[model samples]
Target: MGISVTNISKSYKNAKALQDISFEVKPNELFGIIGPDGAGKTTLFRILTTLLFPDQGTATVAGFDVVKDYKKIRNSVGYMPGKFSLYHDLTVEENLNFFATIFGTTIEENYNLIKDIYIQIEPFKDRRAGKLSGGMKQKLALSCALIHKPKVLFLDEPTTGVDPVSRKEFWEMLKRLQQKGITILVSTPYMDEAALCDRVALIQDGKILQIDTPEAIVKHYPTSLYNVRSTNMYQLITSLKTYEHHHSVYPFGEFVHYTDTRSDFNPEDLKVYLESKTLSDIQIERTEATIEDSFMELST
Candidate 1:
């Protein structure tokens, strides 16, 4: 129905790109891969889309083996790479038509497939892709990818570098596409984007850290977290380190997020100790866990 990857790995010039990465994407589901740059998200996406083969694993898209059925996989999946890969010299309409032709189809033949997204940039159909805005170019690229009416779409950081409004619009477009039974696998570096996916895989250094619904992942954070702030931030940080019970303390915005040095330490004792040191405007409050928080917790 969707995609299944097993023990995939790849390396480039002695540097590992993917290390035994594995995951499953269900049909009609919007699965996201979240990680920062150089985390192997792009490498994995390329392998799954059949643009590259894994060094030590097997994958299947729509039940077709990725390596042996490369052609079939290509025909069944639409991929939008992180970089804008459309023909710069070609007009929007030309680029769209070119991709359609390559897949042995015409724009009109798959008009229904991409009409919603394409129409937004259709008025500029005659404009060269190189001259269009970042968001518009992204829309055009997606339309071209979908022109063949593929069942699964792979977007590698498709919203990066776009304006906030455009980023929101792009995700909305993805939701609409999913309604038509198109399964989506998207990779993004933005932590906030993880919440938009039905499920997400958090990856780092070519290894997956966790895979679950965004809510579930955040809910799994085990330690009690507190937001502590003081006037002398540097001093407060240096002093907090001297405490024997300090578990983890890191700057989080205007405050330092801290967990107890000992599980039994009392918040009242911590407050009293801070006051005794004349740390002005001191405040400590429990904070909700976010994806970024979870990532920091896991990575540390």
Candidate 2:
């Protein structure tokens, strides 16, 4: 079943936590909420999963109202919070069993649903949840979240603080889960991870900046982009920004991304411009727009 959120918003004392956010997730689609901390991702997830109600607008999960039909929404969605909130002292198996029992189900009943992910950590099932590594703890938490076999899974920053390998593995497992026809809505602060989703909504300061497929967002990046590297990267940034034609300059990996004021400016022009500014060992090249680049452009 699909999820739909329409103009949903929430607030704290003096600050708005979410501002007129709206989006839709198709059945079995892997949709992502991409943003940095304090972007209202957690607040939106909480509202959608029926943990909290929005001050404005409405949302439905599998055709159940978030507020009035909270029970149905709660039962239909599996939520993995940003923090690892399972019983720390409970063993992996115990945690899984606990969650299953809460839903009036057994781990074995849903074993096939999570078998691929659970088996990886099954050998350490007897280990205390607190004693497990970050990645293993994540896996165990996910296993518990899925023990009930909900139709929609909401993962809130599930890969945060884990190692790169574990993060990659977690995403792979999510793809496998998606193949089972379960809808997934995940929130992430990592730009690169945005590409993994079928569609993403980039948010900032409690507001939606843009929403589109990763490729569409990147393709919409404005201006001619170039990556310039030099021996003195810091000085190069300063000098480039001071140049008359320099439009915008920011650090991008080992190089600085820059745009020129004039549409006529080309690679050879950039080389001459840098050389005139006394920059040495300069390497300038046009570069493709990445999710991060699109985000930076939109955020500004």
Candidate 3:
């Protein structure tokens, strides 16, 4: 009814791309694969989509085996790779029609399936896909992928290149699609986006660090963290790293996040030390754990 992956491994020449990776995606759930570049997210997506085979273990999508039922799996699932794989030369409408025709279904047949997305790009129906803006291009690509009304949707870093507005709009669309009972497997490098998923797998260097709901993952963070800010952001980072009592210090937005090396941590002590160091406007406050914070703890 959903996706199942177990101990899947892939290799290229002497390098290991993915090792012992496994996870399950529930039907109609928005499952996210969170990782940075070179973390094997693409390889795992390809193997599950039946575009590539694994060196070990097995996977299934929509209840079909990746190896034996590849053809059926391909027909059952829709894939939008990280790159814009659609024809740049074709007009938006042409691309949609082309994909629909190939799937043995007309646009009219699946009009309801992609209607919400297709209408947004319909105004640019005559425009070439390459000429459209990044956001517009994204909509067209998604429309074509859904033209077949696939049971499972695989999107690889779909919002990577779009603007902030487009990124927000795209996620809204995904939420709408989920209400219709389409299982979505999305991969993103942005840690903030991990919170949008029903469940996420934090991946790094071809391995999964953790898999759980964003809230659960954050709850698993083991350390008490704090936000430390001063007039000189750059200087504060270096000073905190060199500070003997600091456990970890990294720039996060306008403030620098820091953890204490000692069990008896005190915010007042850190503020006093920074003041002695001639740092003005210093503010130290306890902060709640975030998905990124948890990921940093696990990935390290």
The candidate maximizing TM-score is: 3
Rank candidates by TM-score, best first. 3, 2, 1
RMSD of each: 1.9, 1.4, 1.2
lDDT of 2 by residue, 190-269 (tens): 99999999999999988999989999999998888999999989889998888888878899889899887888887787
Task: Give all TM-scores, in the order shown.
Answer: 0.93, 0.96, 0.97
RMSD over all Cα atoms, model 3: 1.2
Least well predicted 10-residue stretch by lDDT in candidate 3: 291-300
Candidate 1, residue 169: CA error in Å? 0.8
Q: What number of backbone clashes does candidate 1 have, counting pairs of residues 3 or more apart or in separate chains?
A: 2
Off by over 4 Å in 1: 232-243, 272-278
| Candidate 2 structure lDDT | 0.92
What is the TM-score of candidate 2? 0.96
Model 3, 270: alpha-carbon shift in Å?
2.0
Measured on C-alpha atoms, candidate 3 has an lDDT of 0.92
* Candidate 2: clashing residue pairs, number: 0
